[model samples]
Target: MQLPIDFQPGWAPADIEDASAHRFLFLQGALVVLRDGDGARLPDAAYRDLPIGVLHSVGVLDGRACHMAELSDAELPEGLEAVPLRQLFNRLPEALLAVAGRAQQLLDFARSHRFCGACGHANELFDEGRARRCPACGQVAYPRLAPAMMALIKRDGPNGRELLLAHGARFPGVIYSALAGFVEPSESVEDCLHREVFEEVGLRVKNLRYFGSQCWPFPHSLMIAFVADWASGEIVADPAEILDAAWFHIDALPPLPHQITIARRLINATIAEVAPDHPALSVYGAG
Candidate 1:
């Protein structure tokens, strides 16, 4: 996938104490950001006038300090508007979008872990690492990430190769995408994929190949993606979680998730593998 932003894994502050015009991503909540031109813009001097505290430095992007803040009951500055992170996908470059997601996740980690769960004492931010330390109990809290699995199942049908897709209970009407679920405490990623496939659609899948991964920071989730082949069982949508389930031909599909998602990546990759010449692959800029 072509990523737009150049992001590094670890945090490296350009200047830890610099108080210049630092770039800011003011998140209205966890999922939305203060929209700027084509991406999130830094809060202007007027915004800096607000009692915004010490900017929690997340990382250096292209040799600049990128920070994020959460605002509550504060009026936004003129010419700036709050936009949902999902919507930002269409407006911002992929790399910037990914960076925004990273910033938001770290900001959330800072906000949610202000107090230690194990000990009632407040937590302190470690200067060198992205961790919150508790003074009383010596418990260290790191950024929380929930691991989820996504499976794009394929099977040969009467006519040709087909891909399995499902509509989640959260989706409206006929919209469908890859089958996914969160990993439980004791289960492995493979185990979770199998169990989720069986439970959601009453189907078994095999040849679980790791396709790719994406950071879905809808409240901090690491989406582990896989492509699998249908092994057994019939289509039986679980009423509680799945609205419907079916195997679709490569040429025909419902309105899918956005292009930037790992679900779309798995779908497009599978279609390219099974039917490279299929016209639907054109949507993903494939032959």
Candidate 2:
């Protein structure tokens, strides 16, 4: 996905040091408030008043230095609220949203890898890119992104093509989305796709055409999406992971993921392909 603003991606501190203005995303425990409740707000001056401290450099936004930091309860000023990271998706612009996700992953990396696994020594950010290095043992740790596969299965029906959508046990209400599962160790993404589909819905898929990718920063996941033709198998919703599964034509579909997500993009692309003149395809257009 393209960012709304130009962001010169880098991890080196020197890259952002010369920037004229600085914007920061602050995380209190695990949330950052994008807006205030009663329409009031916390200005950048709030952060500027805090004592001098090191800021994690995210990237330059329109020639200004954009940074992030993990804060404690006492660090937050009055009238500010901390919301879950996921809530910022629709609140911030596309470019700033991307930066927020990056900050989330970076903070996760920093918190988990504070000490070197090999030498048990405190780890520090490397001078250049995003990495943590140990002075004692020379060990380096980079941000870890778990790769996951999402498959949107489609099949030829008596009326027209239908998409196989499922509701996971985690979701509330009747929300349905493409089947997804984490890529196992030593397993290819395609292999993970087939295994997850068969295990979750007891189906076989073919003609796996790679669709696209998205960085889902709920925790840390790289979503690799694909459009696959449902080859065979009865719809069997695995009680463990899937709550329900069904095939729905584009004209009669269920609730889908957000427009910023790859699952929604895959569905939209498939709808456009099956029914070029369908109006639903344009309903959930890009953000």
Candidate 3:
């Protein structure tokens, strides 16, 4: 599924020549500053006087030049509040939320790559690109993205098509989502998917169909989602990874992840395709 945000990513110049027509995103750690108003909105040109450190361009957002900057422990001015990125998930438009995630990732990349690993020398930002170069060892560090896979397994049952949902040990409350795992070295996404499904639930799956991908910016993960058919074996939840695993009928699913997650999208799309007449389609199948 395509995100609603319209962003054109490009390299940022060393210095912004003009700040009047630009939109600034000020971040303190994982917290982004939003103007106190009717709704959550980034600080506009009026607040440009705030302290800025190591500014990075986050491309254009809705025809406006967007930039990101890290802030020190400076006190926020009146009429502005620093809000955590997680709290702004559904509060902001999907497009703005996505751009905010991108800004956060870029800020994180810049903060963690200040020094080189190979050599103990301090690194310098490239003049024309988004990378840090170690003059001593010629080591270049760019933004890091860990590719992970999300699989929504399904099977034919007496009731109808059943979805294999599992409650992850790390999930909040009783929320259940599709099985997911990070890709290892020299392993393709499909291979990782198969391994993750079996390792987590001890179930073999087949008929892998690619669904979509999302940039999950919780410390930086590119989630590739898929729909797979259960091939063999019964549910065997790994105590270390999964709290519970079970097959639920399409119309009788339990509480799922939030709409911002790709897992929710994958599940909704599969249900819409396999069970078009499902009563929940009108509410949850738009993904």
Candidate 4:
């Protein structure tokens, strides 16, 4: 699969000509608003001439069309369909991806919180351009991060070739992924993992091992990944969180999301551990 240009971590260097001083326009949801003459759609161009800063990235938006179609090697010009930048993080490297992801979360949160909840008055951007404060009640607001965890359960069967997998109702076709859930207030990541497993599927997971983490901003989710071994119990999916659960062999697996997602990467990593030529080589499928 072709990687997105904006996916590079630290892609936009810090050094720029008076970026903070200028009134940067938000290029939201990959709208790709085109310029009048040249027909270029960039969010915040330099002097409204040369394209420089982008309001959002491709991944954040619905890139299903682009994903299915072959992406051309060219500058992201104007007149593109609208998609959110959140989808681009998995396409980008870690640090730079975080830059766009966090920035988007902050920008989106600030804009959404502009209308005061208490007084029903519009809020204003803070001095640092990082937060929003209500003019009436003087309420200070910051972007919220929802802490969530995903657990990959494994078990040593008599044949030692089976792995547990899950297919959420929301998941398309036969796509499967690890069990995931949001963290409760004051609950530790470890605690959330165990709870999520039981709630989503009627199973007990032991030997929980942290795999990695990624910023899943499909509306602000910091997904923490872990690997756990199945102790016992049958497959039972939560009516709310999951649709179906099952066990599959390592070599043969169902479809999975393609990207830097901890679920797909860890699955592939484990598959590689047993068999090098894993049929499902990529995290976001073969797209």
Best by TM-score: 3
lDDT of each: 0.75, 0.77, 0.80, 0.59
True-vs-predicted CA distance for residue 86, candidate 4, Å: 7.1
> Residues 9-64, candidate 2, lDDT per residue (tens digit)?
76756332443444454555454453655332223644554443456777777876
Could you tell me every candidate's TM-score relative to the true structure? 0.87, 0.88, 0.91, 0.68
The residue-by-residue lDDT of candidate 3 on 161-195, one tens digit each, is: 89999999988789988999999999999999999
Q: Which candidate leads the pack in lDDT?
A: 3
Ordered from best to worst lDDT, the candidate numbers read 3, 2, 1, 4
lDDT of 1 at 277: 81
lDDT of 4 by residue, 9-103 (tens): 22122223433221222354342323434333223334333343433222222211110011122245444433345444333334434444454
Alpha-carbon RMSD, candidate 1: 3.0
Worst 10 residues of 4 by lDDT: 62-71
C-alpha lDDT of candidate 1 relative to the true structure: 0.75
Predicted structure 2, TM vs. truth: 0.88
Per-prediction backbone clash count: 2, 0, 0, 20
- Rank ordering of all candidates by TM-score, starting from the highest: 3, 2, 1, 4
What's the residue-level lDDT of 175 in candidate 1? Answer: 72
Q: Every model's Cα RMSD, please?
A: 3.0, 2.9, 2.3, 8.6
